[model samples]
Target: MRLWFLIPALMAAALGARDANAQQVHFDIDATLPVRDTELPYTLDLNLTAAAPTRIGVGALLDLREIQKIVPERMADNAIVDNCGLQVRLDDLSFQAQDETIGLDGGVTITIFECSRTSERDFQRGEQKRAILANMSTQATVDLRNNCAYFKLVDLTLTAPEAQREQLLEDDTLDSVKELMLAAVDLVLNETPLCPELPAELASLDPVYENGGPKEIGDGGLGVFLDGSVDVSPSTILDILTVLQQRKLIPGPP
Candidate 1:
């Protein structure tokens, strides 16, 4: 199954109206999911407290290799202009999260194929591979209607190699290249869906909103928090079970 499908399935299974008179219900999930598409394992944890307003918290540790595959795709979608007649590629991507900031380290290869004044003087008609590093802080907004969360880029700082930095200082084209890198990172974080939309029946149980943005978790993972409310009636439980059954996540009555 897709990672998206598995995420909501886990959430649905964990949700319950255990106490009718209790004002709150808590859900805690800790699992390691093997993403078939990416051929990687993701560690996921979700903690939710539901009442008049539910509070949801999630922590996820992602494989950098998976992100490496996505960055190029998102970069292509941006249609970044190559005024410098340069072809760029990224590889050996690594990540670290601390103090609510994610640090990205990778190698960038720039191949100069055509003639440009700067390239003619400073660069050869070949590839120049160098280390590329960046740090970005992230924030999240909850879309309760869609039962998902959207991450936003809070701040970003790109650190280029000395040669590239010098080029950026002199050439407008290099500046565009820098912008392209930032745009690629933005697309990766903002466009990718961290949380899949839950079914309508599940979403309707509570009124949800953002409690806080994503923060640094254990090792190099990201954590997000959301707040909402729920009504744990027998009908509500039945509705949830029916949805799970319809999705074949749980067995129907024998």
Candidate 2:
């Protein structure tokens, strides 16, 4: 069957910043993301590639033990999932500051095994909605140049029961759905704003998916190879630092 997957606000709780000591920052966010939209416009397959190879993923995204860290436990609490019995969970979150970019990386796993009904009538009729579980890793870099951001999808692994996998494979539906989901992920990641306007404040720091942004992609493994950049404000660094402080990710002024 043709399915339009409505991805949750995977970009909502994600934000990062850097200081002089780029390697000294740490943040962790773990929660179940709710899927609200079930219908999405299908797109062609993604051609993913990496701009420049880096060995950053070798040891772990970041070292949380040595550096000050922040973990937001309430990010996925308000996600809407009334239609599809779907949930997206993000874990192993970490961030770092490089010479020119702020990197946010984490693992996102989508599971749709649950069955739910829209209303009492639907429940009585035995009508149910379900989703598939997909495990994916995401890396986003905020470009200090031209005030934009870039995103890369890595290690995208889809999982399902043997029966389900076989059925979709036999019908050629699995490949189609996987492609669409990856594209949707890439679109959401690149379109979401990374930096705030000058003189950043809590209210103005709201960065969500918006149009009229620059994006690029290249070919890679299992619909995972992808990358794109966006422009950001100069004050974004400071704003993010302030946000971290406000969110208690880092220690506040004594």
Candidate 3:
């Protein structure tokens, strides 16, 4: 009887020790985004900021070189000669605990380096009309894909000084500009996975995208999915989550 009691006590102590060690484990994260192109808008010269704060800021740059490449008909009247570039920066970035999605509040800025266009007939181009936008909010969803986690940009609001804002709104390029910026940000998030490569211990966890596509945590920024959380063991998953939650990479229980 005495031996049996001692065995159970020792096992309990060992389990506790393992949990403690898991919590203390540290993971190095790299959020550097790679250059990739999307066919949607004939965007070329896609690049992300070489250096960015580990948390979030100036993650990527969007260069739209040809309006015709994005829309063939647009070329009839206008020729994009100099190309347009947009800088994406997110500040005060945080993760929401209740829902495991990241959110950016008012610290999101999109600065446009005006892309010059020439009227097809005039063959003369005006200087680029640069615009700096600030004080906007957006949210991101995280998904584990191909051995890493990817963040998807979902919501966005573009702002600038009254004069610049009006000019941007009036221009026909606003929608495409917004789309490119959001897409670039999404690519950056994918680059910055919680773990650059998923550890083998957590391999059993399968990605859960409700529509049989990629899994998502929230709604209405880049895309949406029905609600279902990734139920996982504390030892493997919690270890990484603990570190990221502290760094504001992922959310913690409220």
lDDT of 2 by residue, 161-194 (tens): 5756776578554454456556666666565423
The C-alpha TM-scores of every prediction are 0.51, 0.31, 0.38
Clashes of each: 3, 16, 3
Kindly provide the TM-score of model 3 when superposed on the true structure, using C-alpha atoms: 0.38
Weakest lDDT window of 10 consecutive positions for candidate 3: 49-58
lDDT per residue (tens digit) for residues 1-254 in model 3: 00111223222222333322121222222222233342232111111111111110011111112321332232223322223454455544433312344454544444556444566544433344454554555665555454344556677765656766666677744565557656665654554443222234333333232221122223312211222123334453455345345555545779
Candidate 1 wrong stretches, greater than 4 Å? 1-84, 115-147, 155-168, 198-207, 231-234, 239-254
**RMSD (Å) per prediction:** 8.8, 17.2, 16.9
**Root-mean-square deviation of candidate 2:** 17.2
lDDT of 1 at 244: 56
Residue pairs in candidate 1 whose N, alpha carbon or C atoms collide under 3 angstroms? 53-228, 54-228, 54-229
In candidate 1, residue 66 scores what lDDT?
39
Local distance difference test values of all predictions, in order: 0.43, 0.34, 0.37
Ten residues in sequence with the least summed lDDT for candidate 1: 52-61
